[model samples]
Target: MTLYSRVRPLAFKLPAETAHDLGKRTLRAAQSTRPTRAALSYAYGYDHPALEVDLFGETFPNPVGVAAGFDKNAEMTHALAALGFGFVEIGTVTPYPQEGNDRPRLFRLREDRGMINRMGFNGQGMERVKERLEEDGTPGVPLGVNVGKMNSSTADEAIEDYRRVFDRLSPFADYVVVNVSCPNTPEEFDESSPEHLERIFETLAAENDADVPILVKIGPDSPEESILELVDIVRELGVDGIVATNTSTTREGLESPEREEWGGLSGKPIADRSTAVIRAIAEHTDGELPIVGVGGVDSAESAYEKIRAGASLVQLYTGFIYGGPSTAKRINRGLAALLQRDGFSSVEDAVGADLELE
Candidate 1:
């Protein structure tokens, strides 16, 4: 059995958030020095020519990435890269630090291979993250910054919040994601409203002197029409792309008792739903809009399903927790093999291969 498979039972015993913190500490130490980082690279890194993907003006060594919320403060980016992820996206970072919801907010749905969290954008904030990036430098692979407003911010204040964090951290980002669809945060305003989204895109577009690609993260529970409407709005505003999706509040078909927890649902249960959203967006946009799919990606098959639906890339957090350090290597290797089996030359070629036109 794999080391993480052996240890996960013990790790799973701790509260989900506590276990996550401990895991990050271990990763931080692992990536602390050149030799140690090199050791990890030797052990876990998997590189293949067919896994390369050119997106966001940067070449991703592979299309599998660590989704936002895994490295909220930019800690462990290098470690994650060493573990074989093609890229790492940090934050939902606000202008200032946030305590986020009370303790016991993160729960494991072990039976369902899912998790429920009401983290409420809890993070170390932009300045601390900026300092860490400056100290450690961006990971060897592409880095993305997922920016969010403070939970308490109002509708208009929210725009300024995005502006502040983007201004501070965009220099470190290969691409930036405006997280307007987090279900765990306070509903101070219609965050996904067409007007609000337009304001956000316009504000960021103005602040984007570097012309950093700006994308939006959307949730999966919305009606397909509403979701596509939002997509239409972003496309009209010159937004760079979409992250489909965030997490879901839907508990449909869940067998785990923790399934009732009031927050965003991620991992296995949301997989099909998220992929459907990706396919819908891909088909609607006619494959013109770039999509970074997120929702229950835990294996190569799951990741490949999204890529076929139209995601140029896929990200995971809960999967990493369950799959352990070797997750990315395993997935990427499987992807390369899958591509060849399907007669596709690379990840870019495989994207949207399953789409059917009306």
Candidate 2:
């Protein structure tokens, strides 16, 4: 069995957040030097020509990326890259550091192969993340910065919060994601309302002198009509792309006892719904707008479904936790085989293949 598979049982014994911190520490150690990083690259990294994807004016070595929450403080981007992820998105970072929700906020739904978290955007903030990026340098692959406002910020204050973080971190980001759909955060205001979103996009767009591509993260629980309206707003604002989903609030078919936990649901249970959202957005945009599909992505089949539904790229967090260090290599290899099997030359060619058929 794989090393992580062997150790996972022990890891699971710890609180989910604690285990995550331990894992991140291990990854940080693994990336401490050039030789160790090279060793990791030799052992885990995999590449194939067919896996390349061009999105948002950047060339992703492959379409599989580590979603934001995983490297919240930008602590392990190089390590994750060595583990075979094509790109790594860090943060949900705010303008200043903040302690999030109380402890025991993250849980693993073992039986369902899913996770629930109410992290509330706990992060080291933008300055620390930017400093780390400057110190360690960006990873080999593309880097995305997911920016968010402080949990306590009001609707008006939220705009400045986003702009401040974006202004600080965008230089280090290949693209930036404005996260407005996190279910774990305070709901004092309609963060996803078109007016709020417009204000956010306008504020950030003005600060984006570098013209860094700006994308928005949306949650899965929203109705298709509402999602489409948000998509239209994004398009009108000249936003760069969309991360198709964040996490689900509904616990529809979960079997794990942790299902009762109050947090955003992710992984297997949300797979079909996430794909449906991707398909809906793809159809609505007629494949014109770029989409970075996320939610419940754990295997090549799951990632491929999003691609065919019109995702230019895909990201995973819980998948990496369960599937272990080699998740990206395994998925990317499987994707290349699937691409050849389907007669597609590359991932770009395969995007929206099924959407056209519909």
Candidate 3:
């Protein structure tokens, strides 16, 4: 086991968010020197060029990427990239910072291998996050900013909230993700609804002077039909791509004591459901729109399933928690082997290869 694996138990002793912060800080601290960079390159580098993927006008070194909400403030992009993620989407950042929910808001369910978090988009504001990115410079890999509304922003004001963040961070981002499907928010303001989603997208897309690729990050709670409807809207509006799934609210398949916790559910419980949604999009989208498959991806098999189903690229969050620091390398290596075994030359060619099309 690696050092991270050995210390994971101690890390897990803290609240999930605290343990996450500790890990992020550790990564950030380790990345400040040259020796660390060389060591990380040695530990995590994958030499296979066939894992390359070009999506939304960007070329990713591989399909495996780090999802948002892990580095909610864009603090560790360089460090994460050093560890071998092909791309890193940082933050569900808002125009303003908020503390999110109170403590005990995060819970771990080891038995069923899941986590529940009502963190409520708690993060540093866009300005500070952008500063971090500026100081660190963009990661060697493609860097994306995942923008969300401030906690206090009303649904009616959603477009304004998203607009400001997009304008501020767009210049520094290779791409921007408008997050409309965070499950921890209060009810009666479902931003993921067709009406709100359109308004939000139109608002941000209009103000995009950088005209950087803009993506929509949806939640896994969406029913299959709902997913297709959104995909159609995204394509119609010319949204760059869909980041297929945030976290699920349904405890539909989780079997843990903390399953009773009220928050967004991620990790293993979301695997099949998220993958099914991605598959439906592949089938319904007819290979026109691209997909960034998230949710329940902690292994090469799961990541490959998403790729074969239709994802041009894949991202993960909860898996890192369970897989420890070397998780990206492990999965990337496994993906390289799987790609050769499956007779595919590159990740781009693997996209949508398994859809049951007419």
lDDT for residue 319 in candidate 1, whole number 0-100: 88
TM-score of each: 0.99, 0.98, 0.96
Give the runs in model 2 whose Cα sits over 4 Å from its true position.
Answer: none
Q: List pairs with backbone clashes in candidate 3.
A: none
Per-residue lDDT value at 215 in model 2: 90
Q: How much is the lDDT of residue 78 in candidate 3?
A: 78
Ordered list by lDDT, greatest first: 1, 2, 3
lDDT tens readout by residue for model 3, 1-358: 5887789789888888788777878888878887997788788777579888877677888888999888889887878888889999988888898899988798888877778899998888988987887788878899888888877768876778888888888887888898878888766577767788788878877887667998888777766777788888877887888888888888876677889899888888898888888888888878777789998899999999999999989999889888877888888899989889989988887888899888
Q: Candidate 1 clashing pairs?
A: none
Candidate 1 per-residue lDDT over residues 226-334, each given as its tens digit: 9999999999989889999898998898899998789999999999999999999999999989999998999999999999999999999888888999999999999
Off by over 4 Å in 3: none
Better of 1 and 3 by TM-score: 1
Which regions in candidate 1 have their CA more than 4 angstroms from the true location?
none
Candidate 2, after superposition: displacement of residue 288 in Å?
A: 0.6
The CA-based lDDT of model 2 is what?
Answer: 0.92
**Highest lDDT, which number?**
1
Candidate 2, residues 218-254: lDDT per residue as tens digits?
8899889999998998899898899978989999878
